[model samples]
Target: MDKKAAKILMSTFWGGGGWKSVSTPFSGEDFEYAKSQGVMFDPLTITHDEIVQRLHEIHQDDTLQERVVTAFLHSLSTKKVHLRSALSSWALTSQLPLHTYLERRAVHANTSACGDCNFLRLQSDQEYVDADLNVLNFERIKWGGVRHGWLLYCLMDLELLYKDTDAISEVTPEDQAILVSLLEAAQTGDPKDSARSLEKRWKGLFPSSKQERDALLEIWAAAGLLVPTDKPRRGKGGSGDFIFVATWQGDDGYNTDAALRYFAPYLPEIL
Candidate 1:
């Protein structure tokens, strides 16, 4: 394995900045600027086949990450199971209350150890479910398995962007539709359209609340599906960079202008 390339790829794969327990070796901030522009880990020293092989080896084990990827792919292929519903089914299969299952997988406070009996605990299954869903909305994972679905989604996009193989057979039609819509919208007149304007144009696709629509846009931006026109703007109130929006600051931050354009390179050939 090219350790350097692997580190860069991992950093790009796990969006957001600062340190994360899962994204070790490279601080999550290490590739933040490159990540904002749809930059992927493409090392000159490695071949695409080699990279794909390494990815396969890394995921060969039947870890929870792999399971989540499998389940997500299944959901996409069948079009019958929602991602959240699949997660709920997995929780049910654990034969434990969702809270207990999650708590057991949680890292104990003040220590790197996970599944510690002394860790802060949620009172009920619904509490854990609610909490997990909340963070999952941010497309960030904690306690390993909590947000693996979105993690898998990002990984799939990364693989599709670089690898030549048809390895990832399942493509979410909803996501593809959004991507196609954005591409068409960007090509209409102004190529460098802001996130807010694009969101408004795509509003009908996201039939839910404004919050959900905004969240999806942010997630797509973070995943490199949408490229920002400029480097991430520093927040006025010391709130960190604006591209990979780490917080919900309404429209004043990343969503204010049409700063993002369609990342053409990321549009899958399969489309």
Candidate 2:
């Protein structure tokens, strides 16, 4: 390999931030040994999506799989699987993990042109919402594959999400109210709330039989905000609950600028 190729492969093995990582126990040693053998690929300039596309372009050739995996292994260890194996994995699977799903997106464009873009306007599937959450398990594995930079892209988006500066700020009415109050509390650095306060606030949300609002609140509380900082203190009138109030987007001492920025890009006029 040339100097550039060598440098890229070395960096890829450690996941760019620098260090070997195996997503699963089964991935151990094999990819590492391949690195030692000088196998690597520059996933930056070319993406995993392109790699799959190339496989289709050449798959008709009887020898194509062997040839490509040989090339890939030479750049990064192929282990035992050939290119056909990897490419087939892509073609057959209807979906991938959210990480791979986003990174290997087939096309690049807004909704108007591509049939698959989903307009990226952000919608939900029945029983499921495309909630782009944080990398819940990032610390467990430093990185997963050569497709590392795309993961970086995801992290950057999340950082910007927390920065509260995205233009497409769409929160449900209830979440809006909750986020408003929590943000206000954040400003005061007073991060406590009455026990079961969320339960009370969200009670009317499900008019019918709601199995357990407390349980749902627990999940949100765990994610961040709506948290309980300390035990409730008994007050003057006898023991009343100590409560931390929530502030809203339009309320005093809240920052909605970031939300404006995030939601703006998705707006019809700006988009």
TM-scores, one per candidate: 0.30, 0.20
Could you tell me the TM-score of candidate 1? 0.30
Model 1, residue 29: what's the lDDT? 56
Write model 2 residue lDDT over 1-271, tens digit each, in one string.
Answer: 2234334334444464655653321223544453343332112243334433433443445543333222222211211111111222221221222222254333544321222222321111212122212221121112112121122322222222222222122334443343334334434332232333334554554321122333233222222233333434322222122112221111122224433332223223421
Cα RMSD (Å) per model?
19.3, 21.3
Query: What residue runs in model 1 are displaced by over 4 Å at the alpha carbon?
Result: 1-175, 186-193, 230-271
Name the weakest run of 10 consecutive residues (lDDT summed) in model 1.
121-130
In angstroms, the error of model 2 at 164 is 26
- C-alpha lDDT of residue 266 in model 2: 22
